[model samples]
Target: MLLTSRSLSRLGHWAAGLLTGLVAMAAHSAPLVMAIGDSTLFAPLQLAAQEGFFAAEGLEVQVIGCINGRRCLKHLTDGEAQVATVADTPMVFALHAGHRFDIIATFGSSSRDTALVARTDRGIAKPADLAGKRIGVVRGTSAHYFTNVFLLVNGVPRDSVNLVFIDPIRGAEPLLRGEVDAAGLYRPTGPQALEQLGAKGVQLPTLRPYTVMVNLVAQPGLSQDTLLRLLKAAQRGVALLNGQPGRAHELLGARWKLDARHAAAQLDGYEFRLSLDQTLLSTLEAESRWAVREGLVESRAVPDYLELMRVEPLRALDPRAMTIVK
Candidate 1:
């Protein structure tokens, strides 16, 4: 009787284990997530995907690379993607257009990662010098905003410079070939431009710390549970990227085929502040105010930017990790 009872107990334990496995498998079969972004955002997605971080969280992510923030917004608006990594300007535009989305989190925080590159022969050493010159910039992008602010604050009239719209990825080519006098490009591309054409670039000094370039946005009505899972996974990925940069660089280099020095330099200058910082909030407020005054958005209809931002997941994962303003 004792032996028979022990065998039955063992069988029951196996049955419970099987039940748990089934439940786990069912949870893992949830709908896949779609992510859209440019190269900067794409790198982390690729790393997360390659590292099984998403899968471990029971998420299947489909990452698509768009040319710029505008295209990223289009992808989200067109229902081509459910989530996107973009800049503050595009997010503001989407909010004004009445798109129901939330700024989930930010990856980069500084403008140092981006620069205004000019031909060495052009003798363009400062933001003011770009006046009256045709500068290639992706209109409606963070780069565009930076360029506008840099010029205006430096006493360069908005009308003094001719603005030309160009794809950020291909913007350098035109500038290198003398099609445009200067180009606004991110670090990776900026480094590539300097290496390829020996172009000189100037980093703009702005009131706010030039960090927080990329922000992760999600479509409205994402279930709280799902959003929490994604935030957790992303936080995990961010921790990896920040803590183990060499491994991060290795992964990025393998995918982008970037040289070690360029990749390291890009990583070094990038401020991947996972949590929303005071500087970012202040910058967003200032940018929004500027946008309203400059007729970018209706002042009366300006939504509470804080409402459009969701940081609960980050707070939930590690309460001490983020210092939310309010």
Candidate 2:
């Protein structure tokens, strides 16, 4: 029998209500995240995306490549990316410059792969031997900050060294061709530079007494639930990296053109974690103070270092959720 018009109207209403409910659930369920960082941090994102960890967390994440610290900070402040990796120095500077960002977690802290490389012919033996020599560096970057600190700590005057601004990727060429006596670069860029130019180099210690290599940061407005999901996902990714180095190496090689051996070596040097603990907090605060004293930040605008950190999400997650890298 044919349905009456009244029945059809009631059926339409039911369907509409069901559709609305479904849409609301989807909206509340999946959070969108934007990540920006150097090639190293980008490696895990590529792997995690392939492994579906973000999907498991009810998140839709967009990972973007940003090598420059200043540009990454600008993208984050302009709302182009919600979560990004920034060097500890630039994070401190951004805080003092009045941009609002929250540090979600610390991932990598090793500076072992970060080096001050020189052409063998340049006759540069140590940090102190570089006086009156031109050194190529990415100005206003972590490498640059570290280089400056290295000079000062080694009792080398700022004026005694000549700094040439250049892209870190292309820096080795200038050094190899005798354009500069030395170049400051971070791995795998540092490794690539040494391999390509067949140049001899010396690894430098952490420039600042307590400096972190990179940390995850988010915009100020993410909901607590969303933040928690993100931290859990990231922590899971770190665990995955530690347990499956071979797979992690393959992922890095495919996405970032990183050599498997080199990638594995780099990962081996780091102890990955999702914590922004007292050591990290204290280290960042001390570095920020050093920046202010060194004129990297305005003396009067120093924000509380703790204010820059947001660790509740990581703390809320079960400790069993993370894999501690040995």
lDDT of each: 0.70, 0.69
**lDDT (tens digit, per residue) of candidate 1 on 241-306:** 789888888777776787655567666656564666555566677676766776766543666777
The number of residue pairs in model 2 that clash at the backbone is 0
Which pairs clash (backbone N, Cα, C closer than 3 Å) in model 2?
A: none
The weakest ten consecutive residues by lDDT in model 1 span 203-212
lDDT tens string, model 2, 1-326? 89899999999999999999999899666546465555563445546666788779988876666765556777888878887777676776777778888877776666554567766566777667788888888765667766776777777788888888886557467766778878877666766677766646554443453244667788887878888877767766787788888888877766666678866866656666666666666656666777777676665566776766665676677554233221
Q: Which candidate is the best by TM-score?
A: 1
- Candidate 1 — which residues are off by over 4 angstroms? 1-30, 199-209, 296-300
C-alpha TM-scores of all predictions = 0.81, 0.80
lDDT of 2: 0.69
Give the Cα error of residue 274 in candidate 1, in Å: 2.1
User: On a 0 to 100 scale, what is the lDDT of residue 271 in model 2?
Assistant: 62
* Candidate 2: residue 199 Cα off by (Å): 4.8
